[model samples]
Target: MHIPDGLLSMPMIIITYAITIMGIVYSLRKLKNFPEDKIPLLGLFAAGVFAAQMVNFPIIGGVSGHLLGATLVAILLGPYAAILVMTAVLIIQTLLFGDGGITAMGANILNMGIVGASLGYATYSKLKDMNEVIAIGFASWLSVVVGATLTAIEIGLSKSLPFMKVLTLMIGYHVIIGIGEAILTLFIIKAVKTKLPEIGGVPA
Candidate 1:
């Protein structure tokens, strides 16, 4: 849900930029404490997530959806690192490819990078002790929904469309998209756990 330039009001843009900068700063501070050995995984995960986002599938009413992968990255690398990964991905998408608008990049990062990754990690951390797969699946699904909801609100605040209608449509399409996110997240986590066996000791 990348918002293009001119879609958001000036006030909203400024506010989002302020919030996103704070998140990035905080995330970078926390990232400094991450183990050195796990650093390489961040690049790999970011590359995979960037590649995954390129393939967008059609949803109802010609809307398109793709894997956000925030929950998956958060589960694998931790939430702080996930934010950095997502921020890097979004920056490249906006600058080089123009996949998302330059002016709206702040909102995009805040929605997917901060909100999606942070909430997903929190959810997974809370439920993982009880059931790993179920926790991952639910966290992946819910994070997408939450991101979509935030995007809908931002779009609605612009007054360019009806708030409730946009909210309903965004959430409706994202729910279907969330299933794919959940499945992919679970598969990747399971694969990593099987191969490495020592990394996080992900429960089967």
Candidate 2:
């Protein structure tokens, strides 16, 4: 979900911005020696996520659902590179298309890019050896839920709605939306495995 300006309290905005900036910086440092061969794949996934997120489905209280694609990117490229790819997509969406707010950009990136990629990667890495498809699907679903939960928390902290009410609604709606995410993630990962067998990180 892409949060708009004026939804979050100023302090929340400031704190999220600080944390997001630090995350971006740290992610950048981690990828300073990133391989050249993977650059095209990075750009490709960023474009895909940017396009997918453009079609937003309204949920409630200014939140929306769309394919995040962060889990797919993380599983393919690794989390640090996935962060940069997602950061690029969110920045372009916020700045060029106004898909998200300038003021709320940090929180948007934090929710979808950082949290989604990091957690999705962790889950997939832990379980892929057991069952690749299940790991991919579960991690993809969990990423969406986690991102929505974090957004709900931010909105609740801003006093935009009752915490429990919004939390329940956000989670409830996103749980279904996350199914779409899981399906798409599994499809893309499998496609990559079939077409680009030389690529690293993907389950064999």
Candidate 3:
């Protein structure tokens, strides 16, 4: 769920803005150049990601689910590019799709792109040191949970919802939704991992 402006207090926005700026700068600095031909692929992938977010799957009645694809992107592209792609997706969602608001851009970026892509990527790397498949699933699931849980917390803190009730709902739904996310991420990574060495730092 993308949050619009006027939904959060000013202090919350300021904190998110600071965190988002740091993430953007870090991602940019860490960017590794790929082949010239590969540049277009990343842009195209970002567009696809933006579109994917539009189609939300209904979980129960009101709650919806969708692909973060953060783990998938991090697996194939690496954290730098994946974070860039994800951040771009959220930006476009705010400007073009109006899924989020311009004022709330920083918050969305922090929760969705930075947490989902960069943090998930780092977590994946740590666990992947043990098992590839397990790492893949865990990373994917956590990314979704982190974003959803944080969103709920933010909204609850805004007093739009009671904190405990909202927290329970967000986590409860994401637990089931994350299973699908984990399965989907694992399947995709497994299918292409052999062909793409960069998927998990394996040399091509």
- Candidate whose lDDT is highest: 2
Sliding window of 10 residues with minimal summed lDDT for model 2: 195-204
Alpha-carbon shift of residue 147 in model 2 (angstroms): 0.4
Clashing pairs in 1: none
- What 10-residue stretch in candidate 1 is worst by lDDT? 195-204
Whole-model Cα lDDT per candidate?
0.86, 0.87, 0.77
Arranged by TM-score with the best first, the candidates are 1, 2, 3
Best prediction by TM-score? 1
Which residue pairs show backbone clashes in model 3?
A: none
In Å, residue 140's CA in model 3 sits off its true spot by 0.5
TM-score against truth, every candidate: 0.93, 0.92, 0.86
Clashing residue pairs, backbone N/CA/C < 3 A, model 2 = none
**Across residues 44-94, which tens digit of lDDT does each residue of candidate 1 receive?**
889999998998877677777888877788888888888899999999999
lDDT of model number 1: 0.86
lDDT of 3 by residue, 1-204 (tens): 688878777778888888888888887776745444566767876876777677777777687787778667776777777778888888778888788878778888877777867778888889987998888889989988898888887777765657888889888998777777788778766765676555354211
TM-score of 2: 0.92
